[model samples]
Target: MLGASRMGAAPSASEEGEGEPPLTPSTCTFTRLVAKMAADKIVPVALELGGKSPMVVMGDADLKRAVAGAIAGMRFTRQGQSCTAASRIIVHRSLIDEFLAEMKAAVNAMVMGDPLDEATDIGTIISKQQFEKVKAYIKRGEADGGVAHSLSQVPTDPKLGEGYYVQPVIFTDLPSDSPVITEEIFGPVTALIPFDDYEEAVEIANSSEYGLGATIWTKDLKTAMNAVHRLEAGFVQVNQNLVVLPGLSYGGFKKSGIGKEASLEAMLDHFTHKKTIIINMT
Candidate 1:
């Protein structure tokens, strides 16, 4: 059975099992449960888990486009809930200020309110529990010496209801060890880490234990390619937001997952097995 990793309170493995080996792709915690069951039954399983994706902004990047891409990559869809969201932004020290300013303005301009409304750009958190969790992360970030910049004032619209709506946040002046920089907030929040040069930038981008997705923004083709090769993410994007299209192999490295989906790899893993049949016809 196909299962999602990131969603909370998923169906139990017993409920989904039909006497066959199960295929599960869920959170790291949930994967543990699935792994136990598979081990007990001696069946094969697949798992996909959490991420703390990073977007690297090089000194030579086009500030205007990079800022827009960062905002779009982090906030435009699902309020940064996806595993592939570029929640961590590592930028060159020289371009950090300009990138942050432009990113702040672009994020502030987002429309947050009723999701049913056509004009809404940002939506509410999935639940109250999720809202609180995200808020706690924000507070933890501040305590860790990261300065939080509120991108939007809480909307006063009565029509928005009592849903778990949260303002987007950007943390700056943070060390690479900050919780905001290291953990996956899974909210409309992003952190900026300044690097002195290309080597430092690449090092910081790969510092995370989660190697799901990463993006590189730079005008120099050589620099972009170098980062694309060096970043530890399973999927690396260059000069654009992280997006998964049809027919592409989708999965993460390290703790991200074990198998890919929606591509040839998925077909091979879940649909077919190779066998060799030989006969002494000669």
Candidate 2:
């Protein structure tokens, strides 16, 4: 059976129902009996919700290095269909133009087509629904009066016609309140927000409702460390896209997501519970 809920509707009985078989005969009488199931028999569940992560470029950051890192952060792993994609870019006002130019060049060099094609740098999105969602955000960006810089025209291949594909799009001079800036587009769309100083940049980056992951690119150790302290994100990357080391914890704060995954720490947290042991040697 299929069940659907209207926007803002409260959870329904059907939605709350769990089909898992009861662990004991008496447990079946309870309204929600899944809690009584045996720990060893219970199936594990995981949720991978994406986020609107940002990249903050400090004033003293090397422009070449910042641009390279920013592009990699934004466009890495096929636009990071995963939850950790850096969709927003916050740069110092002085270097905004230079960074945008370099980013544009880098995106333009990407060859979008078949995922199996050795020459293809970017591939088609997962589904038509996702494609439409991404295209709607692109249209919203144009409607919100943000300048759209598309890197490549849509391909004419009939084989690719069966799937959804969109060119990489960048928006400049986006207002802080714009939907493109505020919402998670979950595609190859990036917005460049300019700030006059470090404090202002931190404010803009932390103002979002979602606080999953953030990136700070700078050559100065002090600036990177300071920004890391100020940013209110679960994962803070410094001058690189590989933020969480293997066997380290990975998760988000605020509305971006719940709980953690992707490391030994998360596995231990999920699998075990701590019990205080008290003993008195009198």
Candidate 3:
């Protein structure tokens, strides 16, 4: 029920799980698995899948606030493990130096230790397997010609060093095609991609296979609106990090997934079906 390997039988609402029944099987999971179930006609799947979300920092952006927004988007609150995490930061070339410096400082200052401690900003990675996976991504990033800056330092104390802990890292000087910039690493790691102007920024953000969520930081209303019109992501945040509340649809476009969540449409998706009753009274 928890682990992917353990979740053998897909969740079914029907009393008898022998055959495919009329059920709404909503999932936010692996794309390949979803396709298999969909082909078998298991149910009308409402999938909310993966993301390689982006954060756009325009030349006119409020640098201070954008730094905060980028950090929050990367999920420093939970070590950047969220599906909607802003793994790619596309900033105007003019603002790259300032944005990167502030972002590095913000990540470096985060407290890393036991989650039970309120002061701790980041806890250990989910598990040793996940820990290794994230580490491998970091290595892959370096191999791809991305300059790495790690905020995580090996703790000197034996007790603090026991668990699967990794320092928050940011990669720069990588091309847009790098896997570290394109794939979902699902860790406290983000890639900084520099662009020349607004058009280039949108181009980089839209280039990803994922279109789940995105954020744009700019003081220019015109530029923000232009991005909103062009960026392919389902959920777009202007001047803020991604945050969804009740009554708002939360889902993605493209390979990111299908359908909606946390809104009335999601509830209706499962509860309602089309029924046509024709009666003629003569």
Winning candidate number (lDDT) = 3
Q: Cα deviation in Å at residue 199, candidate 1?
A: 1.0
54 Cα displacement, candidate 3 (Å): 0.7
The TM-scores of all predictions, comma-separated, are: 0.88, 0.80, 0.86
Write model 3 residue lDDT over 21-80, tens digit each, in one string: 212122334455766777798667676777889999988889999999988899966777
Which model, 2 or 3, shows the larger TM-score? Answer: 3
TM-score of 2: 0.80
Alpha-carbon deviation at 247 in model 1, angstroms: 0.6
lDDT of each: 0.77, 0.70, 0.77
Residue 164 alpha-carbon offset, candidate 1, angstroms: 0.8
The 10-residue segment of model 3 with minimum total lDDT is 1-10
Worst 10 residues of 2 by lDDT: 1-10
Better of 1 and 2 by TM-score: 1
